[model samples]
Target: MSSNRLKILHWSDYACPFCVIGDKRLNEVLEECNIKDRVDFEMKAYQLDKDAPKKPHLKMEEVFAKKFGISIEGARDRVDRIAGIGRNEGLDIKFATVQFTNTFDAHRLTKYIASQGKDVEKFIDLTFKAYFSDNLNIADRNLLIDIAEKAGIDKKDASKILKGKEFSDEVRKDEEEASDKGIRSIPHYIVNGKYVISSSEKSEMKFVLEQVLKDEAEGKLNINE
Candidate 1:
């Protein structure tokens, strides 16, 4: 429970399919090592589709098609493949029904939740399920508040955070830091502020956790490296 244990800065976007899968696998590794008690898990902000419009809400399939210059059907197939990967990680992904909303507000809410020192893993899970599985409009204030409340956060606090522009600067700062670090994708985990692991591979995730834990045990964590 010491503050000196390994700190993991996890950068992710809720809309990204790989992030959800990677998070689940990382949670499994943390559970196995009982590192939750010894490590600080911080969720960093990243926006995959920063210029996405707000109105005339775009379905994920169409969004993919436009982004990749593919047909809608092709996008559907690609999303199905991604959803299959999610299924392997035990996620109930309904890509067809997913609405692509700007996650700037959601990222702000996440930063606010982190400020309270609550379990951000649960918050991220709820947000992912709300958007990808439940097909809820995460950008909507009421929906965001409801999701936050369900994650054990106070409804009043959630309402206040969602209503105003609170934590917006903090979220933007995290996003800038991610850009400076050249993290171009989601599910990026930086351990001890040194080890960087991208992608959602279970084996790679486990290896990162083990390495961090070994460093903690041996007192040889090179933060500058």
Candidate 2:
């Protein structure tokens, strides 16, 4: 944060619907403010349910109802509400048929892509679509390899990474750091390593990021990341 640009650390899960909404809104603000080049993004991985199975065995509503002790109707309402938000953002989020599965491999693959200085955002966006829109199983190695290749990653390299334990530590480190900070939410964004911003408040998010830019230009004291 004691640097010339604004730093954005976003902690989110690929399988989270709220993350889809938040990410879309945040990117909109960045583009609208015309501050894309003045900000740096570090997309950290955080799984809501780390123990989720590699393949979903139930409908999205059924799983939510069982997990939260709610009626199937109530669970459907919950998912539908989030889907409504995604619709407002012009996204296709079919949580009703979501393939809710373990995201460890997807997160690990993202870490590997970022480490290789590849198009991390493209890969992340593509993976998000695969889960929320296509209702595809992100934990599937073949699906991951396909998504990675479409994101401009080498198909062979992605296959090798998925076949082995590569970049797992990076994903774990992100999770551990979020835990130490007592962060228990997805689509959480930290600015300057201090101020927390959420896309849930669009005006506030725009204001906060713009303020960081102004403070940086003025040489104000910044909280270092």
Candidate 3:
């Protein structure tokens, strides 16, 4: 088998619960196989509820109910289900405390973090936990800088990037690219530049990765998405 790694471009939004769940599942599979070195994962940006109002720091349940026209109880149930999935993957998802905020700046910061070749996975996990579990407003620059520093980013540089809208264009480009590819949902995984798995269906994700590795082993350069 060739030692080539498969590249997976994952488009997701930190504000979305399902995207976080999908990310956890993908990470689990990669870790279980000891294939961290064999997989190149890039996280793109996608907004789930782009039109949500930015004020009063609505809870996840409130946001869900308002956006989907469902009752608060129904939204809570949905959050519970998603939270259950997250808990299984070692995430402490606090549905009630989740504050849905504009993630544009957060996405920009992520792009900047990737540019630094830092541990983006840890950065992303911390950002999700901060916003969804710790009730931190991700759109706030100070909060973003703190999270970035926690992810090993330089405090001064993180503050500069967050304060000045650095990497915002790159983030917008990523969103445009996702739209160009007809991606309308979060947790979209584009594997090997061909096989596109929408949402993190764990079994499907594993199968796709396995196939990519198999093809690489056979000296075949097939793009699946």
Which candidate's TM-score is highest?
2
- Encode model 2's per-residue lDDT on 28-114: one tens digit a residue: 898887766767888998999999999788888988899899999999999899888889889999989888899999999999999
lDDT of 1 by residue, 1-225 (tens): 335566788998878888888878887888887876666678898888777554427778888899999999999999899999888778898877787778888899889888887776788888998888998777787888887887778999998888888999998898899889988888899887788788788889888777776876787876443
In order of appearance, the predictions have TM-scores of 0.89, 0.92, 0.89
Local accuracy by lDDT, each model: 0.82, 0.86, 0.80
Candidate 3 global CA lDDT score: 0.80
- List pairs with backbone clashes in candidate 3: 194-224, 194-225, 195-224, 195-225, 196-225
Rank candidates, TM-score, best first. Answer: 2, 3, 1
Candidate 3 residue spans exceeding 4 A from truth: 32-34, 53-56, 222-225
Candidate 3's TM-score? 0.89
TM-score-best of 1 and 2: 2
Q: After superposition, how far is residue 2 of candidate 2 from its true place, in Å?
A: 14
Where does candidate 1 clash, by residue pair? none
lDDT order of candidates, top first = 2, 1, 3
Error of 3 at 215 (Å): 1.7
Model 2 alpha-carbon drift over 4 Å, by segment = 1-3, 221-224
